[model samples]
Target: MTTFVLFGGTGDLAKRKIIPALYSAFVNGRLDANFSFIGVAREALDDADFRQRVLASVSASIEGSSANGGGSTPATLQAFLALTSYCKIDAREAADFEPLKQRIDTSGANAALFYLATGPDLFIPVVQQLAAHELVGDNARVVLEKPLGRDAQSAREINAALRTYLKEKQIYRIDHYLGKEMVQNLLVLRFANSFLEPLWNRKWIQDVQISISEQVGVESRGDFYDHTGALRDMVQNHLLQLLSIVAMEPPVNANPDAIRDEKVKVLRGLHKFTPEEVSKHTVRGQYRAGAIDGKPVISYQAEPGVPAASRTETFVAIRAEIDNWRWAGVPFFLRTGKRMASRSAEITINFKPIPYSIFGTNQRNLRSNRLVISLQPEESVELFLKTKEPGEGIRLSDVALNLDFAEASTSRRVESYERLLLDAMHGDLTLFVRDDELGAAWDWIDPILSAWQGDSEGLKSYISGSWGPAAASYLLAQCGSAWGEEYVED
Candidate 1:
């Protein structure tokens, strides 16, 4: 039995992801029987108003969810609603926190999970207020959402402030991407499969690519997007985190810290860039006016709150290498962008090609085997292998041995938020980011950022609704490879 306090209970994230996820967890019996929610905000909403907002968010999410409300009976919904309450307190005002403190004390919550869904600026104040009011429980936990900071120094400041009041064990820095079923499945695919582990090293692999593309522009987030470009916004956290998981050495145990320790080693293993290497290994592109599916879209410069003179990159392609025995000489290509040809987030492993084709040179265009873990418009894994084409002749063709998690399973796919949020409630930090991991990631990223700051090379341009600038492909071409386009959404 625990109490959940949502700091940004009425914000867009809560409305779209958090609230729906909590409700789904409740419906699935993933939550404790004595669990409840305390929706905290400065909205001046009473208990009833907050419950209604939760209902609306839940209803909207339900309509689109494959769970279709998850066997939630009216009585159960009401029971869940009855467990909820609200508090209207300006976190900036220390006095207002007293009321929240009193309410928590009265409720007798064994442990409380404080979720800071608000901006980075609010994290410190809220933690300070919670400490001052004596509302922070010995068994309490705090959940932090990203972007942790605008950059490394800011992230360090935030961590320092939080540490002043909360113990490291009590902090859970959540990254929803890690909560995805397929991402979690990566462990099983590698460790559990005896056939794949021996060939997991650079000796049997060529290069790896982690591509996360988007077909949509900044929309209303131009103000935020303008200040944070592709490298800082995406590559620093999401992309780096993915790379760590893919490249990390096997941990000693399944303990949360053990897994995290290995992950941080990967981040630290990332080859730091020099000023000159930064320019040669990285490509930054801004989207220009172009067509998507036959319709034209405005350039990133024309987006609301954007400056026409803005050189902020909407797209970034990076060639990263881990300086470790397992991955030495194996390049990890990381690229992500807005207003691209497809909406995809996938990590593709290109295995080294056969030294000699058994079927003779007649097998034209014989390609390397590829293991693609896609987490996008669809959740699936496909192993592209060369197969003998059924015929009287010795013809070979590539075939995908596919594992579509959605199609093969009858159980409802768990939402990323649902998995991570529930894990936070259960005090499971396996999927959350650690402070050292974050620091190491920033350490590796800061040099490139500094180089980009001083670069006169300027931004390359890619037309909207494309796979970014041709320069991204060129980054791979240098290594005798290319970006995988087969999985791009149509």
Candidate 2:
């Protein structure tokens, strides 16, 4: 039986996502019955208290289960709660791990996963502490969450620190987005289906748009948000990883190295942005007070721990390019923001218009074909094709052929973290980002960060309930493009 140890187990991520995910997995019998979960935190809580917390957290959310077409029941909840236990230990001190070591030794499971859900700074120390207690065995795996570092050098430092205790294969660097059902489907949508492969290039794809927008500001994590900004927090990891998946060449096989090899190639092909080029390709914005669904909200500056003069961007938009044959001139537009008009995460692939319209003069300004993979606000894929307008004199209109994954899949849809955690247990590195990928991503993104600082591009302000700064629209307009349909709330 495999044992999972969660450091910082009483923290928000543990309570809200990790524990709940474990519960769901446990209830479904995906986790072995002999398995044990040992949560370690500074807080002194007994096993019963920890179980109650898990029960409370899991029961609060009404997540739709794809398996039953219903929510979790009290019986299922109780059964899952039985698998958990807690231990109190300070992650910083190696000596504090004695109790945790005793618990693991007693469990008698050689296969263990040491999940560091704490901040990045503590990652190394936690591993060292675990190593001191002999809790990190030869077969054990260590999982580290994102925001790996503030920049490339820092990331390397973290990697170097980890290497002192763990090997590259033993470390699982998770990017939860990769675990999402829709994200995994991206490969299937591109490679499995023959319809898209031939046209998946600069010759046929006019441009691609990747947007990850949030409707809420940094209500609680203002301090953390102030330092990281939109670029490092979202673009460097989440958005860039998505771009690689969208633009990468077909892997030799679906194996870990095969898939990651193609992704690395995509990252390497990224056209590095010069200072002047950065100015043209990027735009940063900070949200100002405005109404969201008729409710007045505070500006980013008003948030706790944020100074009035803070230049930290709440929004960012960039037009990136891959300098390879497959995607030479095609622009990949990436945008992410907080306090946007609506919450959405999607990728839109705009196919080039036909060589010459047969109904040329009459059918001017007709919409081109588009493939949209919506990751949130319900996961679905839509193919927007030009269709004949009914009762029209040779008119054409665009309509979507949509496929909703939630409605189609009969099996239970696993949460992103749930699938990823299981993968970590099974030692699957396919969905996790490797060091080379990380370095390449930072290499491509570093110049943009430097350009922003050198240019002193103060955060351009946009209304709270808006798409982003006007410049974002103009950035796309220069390429004769625009954001896909916005979700308007009633």
Candidate 3:
């Protein structure tokens, strides 16, 4: 039997994401009947009350599942509800782990996972308590959720603390983006298909664009978002990880280290940005009051609990490059923002335009061939290829060869957390980030953060529903490029 323990079981993350993911995994037969869920929180709720709370959450989240004929049957719900147990514990106190140890021993499951869904401040203390109580055994694994730290130094400190008790192999640093089906398929899209491998380098690829936009502002998380901003919250973990996948060389093998080794190389290859270069290549913005989909929205500063003079950037755009051979001179444009026109996460790899066109100037209007991998709203891969328009004219038009992941499969697409949770249970490290990977990412990103600390030169403002600030467009224009049209349409 496998036992899953959630350290912050009653919090929003555990209730809204963790429990629902577990339910999905349970429904799909990924979780066994002998499995147990021990939810630990400081709220002091009993097993029945915790179950009731979870049930209500599950009911609301799974309502959409029910609409699609995927709801849990009554018996299935009862059986799943049976596997759950609750315990109240102060994560910081070593003595409070007594109940957890007793429950694990009584449950008779050697495989255990401690999911630290709590705040970053509590992570080290909880681990210390688990170690003190001998609750961390050879078969135990600890899963960490992100915004790991504010910067490189803090991240290193957290890593050092965890290393005291857990080895690198026993730690799973979750980056939910890597668990997305389409994001994983990027590996297959690049490596599995021989057709794309030829053009996956700087010689044929002109530029790369990675965008993560949100339609909604910080409705409830304004307090948390006030301090973090766009770069640390999104770019550090999610966008950079995606960039690594797209730019990394072919790994020696599909093993965890093999994949991560290539990823680290990409991160290290990232061209170091000097203070002057930062001003030229980076653009930061805060969204002001405007309308999104005809609904009025508040600015970042206007959000509740946020100071009026906040300099926190709700949007970030950077034109970066890797100094290595495979990606040298090929610019990578990364952008992320809140209160954008639409919510989307995608990467577009634009191939260089055909040289010395034999078809003459008439066909020059055709868009460049692009391979877009979209991760959100829907998971899909689209190839934009130039084709002749249906007429006597020799004009060319770009058409997409699309693969809709959801429509092609009868099996339900699992949420990112669901796939990640199951991978954690099975001791799969492929999707989980390694310590050095995290370190390397922060090491490269810290300079950009430092450059923005006291300077306000390039910070611009954009309307809430806009694509981003005008400077983002200017950054790309200097490279004779532009943001992909997907952002502008919505």
Best by lDDT: 1
lDDT of 1 by residue, 1-490 (tens): 6889999899888988998888888888888888889999999899999999988888887788756387777887888889889999788998888878888888888999999998888999999999987767679999998888877898999999999999998999988889989888988787778898899999999999999999989988898789888887799888998998888878888899999999999999999999989988999999999988789999999999999889999999999999989999999999999999989999999999888767776556756899999988789999998777787877878899999998899888888999998898888999999999999988998998899999866579999988998888889999988898833321
Q: Report the alpha-carbon TM-score of model 2 versus the true structure.
A: 0.95
Q: Write the per-residue lDDT of candidate 3 for residues 413-488, one digit (tens) a residue.
A: 7789999999999999999888888998898888999999969666799999999898899888888788886333
lDDT leaderboard ranking:
1, 3, 2
The TM-scores, one per candidate, come to 0.95, 0.95, 0.96
Model 2: residues >4 Å from true position, as ranges?
Answer: 63-71, 486-490
Which parts of model 3 have CA positions greater than 4 angstroms off?
66-71, 486-490
- Give each model's whole-structure lDDT: 0.89, 0.87, 0.88
TM-score of 3: 0.96
Q: Which 10-residue span in candidate 3 carries the lowest summed lDDT? A: 62-71
Candidate 1 lDDT for residue 9: 95
Which candidate, 1 or 2, has the higher lDDT? 1
Q: Find the 10 residues in a row with the least total lDDT in model 1.
A: 481-490
**lDDT tens readout by residue for model 2, 1-490:** 8899998888878877888787767767778768888888888899999888777777654453433213567777766667679988887776778877888888888699988898899898898887777777778999998888878898899999888888888999989899999999999988999978889998899999999999989887788889889999899999999999999999999999899999999999999988889888999999999989899999999999898888999999999999999999999999999999999999999998788877766564655888999998789999988877889477777789999997888777888988999999989999998988998999898998888887665459999999999999999989988898532212
